[model samples]
Target chain A: MSLNDPVDDETLLEVRDLQKHFKVDEGLISSLLRAMTGSESDYVHAVDGVTFDLKRGETLGLAGESGCGKTTTGMSLVKLHEATDGSIRFRGTDLTDANEEEMVQFRQNAQMIFQDPFESLNPRMTVYDTIAEPLRIHDIRNETARVRRALEFAELQPPDQYFDQYPHELSGGQRQRVAIARALVLDPDFIVADEPVSMLDVSLRAGVLSLMERMTEEFDLSVVYISHDLSLLRHMCDRLAIMYMGKIVEKGPTEDVIEHPQHPYTRSLINAVPVPDPGVGRERVELAGEVGDAIDVPSGCRFHGRCSEYIGDICETEDPPLEAKADFDGSQKVACHLYEPAEGVDSTRVDDVTDTTAPDDSAASAND
Target chain B: MATQDEPSIFADLDDSTVDESEEQVNRWKRNLRLWRETLGEQWRMLTNDLLVKLAMVTMAFFMAVAIFAPFIAPHQPLNRQYETDAELIIADWVDPMFIDSESVYVLGTTAEGFDIFSQLIYGSRAALLVGLLAAVFTAGIGTLVGLTAGYYGGKIDDTLMRIVDFLYGMPLLPTVIILVALLGPSLWNIIFAIIVLQWRSTARVIRSQALSLRERPFVKAAQVAGASDWHIISRHLAPNVLPMSFLYGAFAIAWAILAEAGVSFIGLGDPNRVSWGTMLQSSRAYAALDFGVWWWFVPPGICIGLVVISGFLIGRGYEEITNPELR
Candidate 1:
């Protein structure tokens, strides 16, 4: 995706070809030697090329396993990590090239909720100061009243009770609430909640998620929820986008992606989640290899190395673009060679697909 | 849905509601209460350590001597009496009243008849002045360098850290002495030299902390909250790194005191000042070690050792607070 794509009138954020690559710092002597030798520095392509769009009051789930760059994509939305390349057009302004003045305006409108509440809230700042900080930064008046309202909004009753309390004094749930309050105090139009309840107790997860749901509705906010937890994503997100090694392999409505995952990577991920009923047996397509280092990502298809249904040389030689398959509806997009258009009728590819479909067609072809 | 109505486990923790009446309390009383609530625990932890308690007592005593030196010392530190020396009297342990009824020297006098006790009392003022002032300046410079290096890391971090490495490579004492000699011998010059030499260690330590602190989620959250680089460094990064700054500041005091002593002992100290190092230097020149004029040299040597040790003990005590893993 690039800036040439048409934007919808309701779109709140349009990220196109976003990429963030971090330089691998090989110690002092090695770097110096490399510099002297005129060797190119190596980079870890954490987020290779991510593109997505969110409309007003929409919650898009970014689901991937750990180290898949979902968090990096989330952070880049708020300009916490400047995109090494590509454009993040929030509202009408391109955030990647925003100046200080524009960045301040953007920052006032977009906020982020981090994954770990323990580490996200400043330990030294009181709950009141934590919530009041953004107000003070924006030069908004009546900080005390807004902070108190935010506290009450987060369901911490009697708002004043938490004013003087520090992060260490609060429980995990309460700390997350304060973090949410801080994010909401600005009355931002957009928010990126990066696994907001991942670090909390399982018992308290629902409360926090429900609070976030209420905040999104009441404040009319656009949210991007990034998580590795598929169950949580299914529960909270309206649409789901599955990521694999810094690239979005599949994206569609949440229920469609969950029930009818098209990509091999997404299929493996869904199969990996255990079923509670012992009587119902499910086939597990165990992937072959572990996730490779981002410094040297696999060529062709990033997931081809671990794919169970390795079809032909095409999967090894040609990278597949993310597009809607000929068979599936246009809303669901998948990046896999198996779903290529019918016009490219190679005999070897046809034979391979038939052979692969013989055993698993009953279970895998249910959506078809 | 039933669980939603149930009182949360945290309901009991909500008892300490903010009292509206307390807002009307006097500022002095409020500040005092604030201090007790915030710093009182750390102070209690420090005092609980026996070594830190001893260090605090020793430091307090030295500070008292420095502050009340004029009223406490019986004679002026620079006063000398050469008139009674013609008799070729080697030494007398008697009070100064015997020779001159109006004068009193508790620890007798030096070879030039300068008052030993008065010099010892007055010397602490210079030692502490250099130590405390150098410490404050070193920590300030170190914090700024570290905060800048850690926050804007990349070429800026590389350049600042390389400078720290260069400073770290120099031999501290000789380098400080050379700089002090070039700057001219004075208390401010010595403090300046000590600051230049000692700040690198604090800078390096704080930079590593800032390196980690800048990556912390809270700092990133602060960045997302519209904080500028200056705002993030001063408000988020600096406060988190402050306890470490203070911890290094204590160690910087010890280093500066020793550096000042080394400079003064080499005869580069301020000529007009009566520092403990100058006292030892003058006594050495007069061959007090061989002549057994213990009063002239021993007090200054012991005083230097006591103050440096006190500073180290306090620093060690603070280490536990900053890094609980050390405890």
Candidate 2:
């Protein structure tokens, strides 16, 4: 649903048409070479036209491979990287237009949990100071009590032992716990957790994830959980959005999307996840080519080059709008020409083969 | 398989009975253990190096003497009336037991009849002050400029780096000479000359370090925390850049002291002050080297060597502390 719908669900954050482009400059000699070769200058579209909503008390998993704009999207949410073009609305307030003073207030309500716990934490600072930093910056007067409460909430108990420990003294899991404690110390409602456990060891990853899950429920936190792992996303995220080359390819309820992925890229990602059953072997749907450069993305559908079920001419000529998939609940949306009846696929016939629950009427209407 | 199964049996039992307090205690114990381990590692590195220990002791001694030089010296090195013209030429050459010649000039006299021992003691004050002042000024300005340029890479970086390049290409000694010529011969002018000529080297080094440090995830974390640019630069960036700045500052002081001495020897220093450089200058001018007056020049030269060596040792010790790979 478009954000214009006057629904009152306390939408904590809304990002629309977010774009970040980095200009690549060729050296003098390289420019001369390019001039001779007639090569055009280029720009990397790090986050191209990303739009999403984060309702209060809901976790939205933004799933994507490396360089797929997930981290860029997270960074833009906090205004760490300025958006080239977009509107980021928080509590119906446009953060994109927020000045320095306004941003400081916004930061008090919104915080971030970084990817690598080892590197994200300041090695020089003790755990107490790291957690206390936000309290000090935001001018939360009751410093000691707030820090103690935050440490307690993060499941780092006794608080006294950890208060004096530096980041290097803590293990990977402990460090991640400290990072979480630091984020929660501000008592923020919304948080962007950017691949928070990706750098931890496999054995320790679950502990961090569980702690996050507990913290999310305990604090009533709305989080944008960014990761490349589909299994973890399915477990933690209420809703899921799969990204490819800086664009959202598919989005739906976590279980719905995982069980019946509509987009080819989403299907490939789901199938790629290793199942626990060693006996039940499934064919790995390996896409033909590598992801295209974000600097110069291919024309029409960005995934056309790597899409398995590409039509003869339609996929190359027209960019597909993100419309409701045929025979699925209106909750699910996919951006692909293959789902459109106008592209020579019959709505009823396609719906019959694809195991989608909703009727094809909405899909057909969107196509028309 | 049996051993693994046995562990799982214990794990299940442990999971069921896991007390939250016990878990907390375990985490605390583990962190404390790790801290102790890292401390041990650092201690091992410190104790294993004989040169570092020797250097530390030497620096401590030099700093102690430099701090207390005023109280320990018998006569004020700057006092001219205590040194008479008669004592300057005749005292050492005339008698074997000239203890009573002219009011406690124990190390004999300069051409101007200044006590050589008193000058050596008080000379450290000027050398140390000028060296420290110039070092601090150069390091502070260089670090600020370097961090800003390197961390926020763009046209600003390009421009500042170009300035660094231009300064780096100029011969440091000649540039100092020209500046001193323009400013006239004085202690302040020498300090200014040293700071202007030496800051570029530190700027280049700090800039390269900042370039690498900016990419560190901690910096990115600071950004995500909604910290203002100034806060991040001062609080986060400056601390990481400080150890290197300190190391550079120590080396810069050594060079500044040497340069000051060179200028003073050439009569570009304070004319009235009885510095080691002035002693060397006057000794040479009076042909103490041509005559058999070894005591006239040897003490000042040795003092200069001691200062340079002590500075070098301190710098070496600091380098070892900051560089984990070497440690």
> Best candidate per lDDT, number?
1
What shift in Å separates residue A158 of candidate 1 from its native position after superposition? 2.2
**C-alpha DockQ of every model:** 0.31, 0.19
lDDT of 2 by residue, B1-327 (tens): 012322111122233344556645755785587668756865565556776567557656656767898888876776553324664533332111155464456666666655677788877777887788988988898998899898888899999989988888888667777787899877788789889888887888888988987777677766656667787787777877887888889888888888888888887777766677877888888887887666778988887887777777777777787786765
lDDT tens digits, residue span A105-127, model 1: 88888999998999998887878
lDDT of 2 by residue, A1-368 (tens): 32224656777788776888877877889889888999787889888777777887789999988999999888888877889987899878898787787787788778888888888887766888788777656655555566677777667888887887888888888888888988877667788999898888999888888988887876678899999999999999988999888888887678878987888899899888989999988878998889898987787678999888776465665566554555454456677776643233432431121222222334333322
Which parts of model 1 have CA positions greater than 4 angstroms off?
A1-9, A27-39, A340-368, B1-36, B82-103, B325-327
**Each model's lDDT:** 0.81, 0.75
Error of 1 at A168 (Å): 1.1
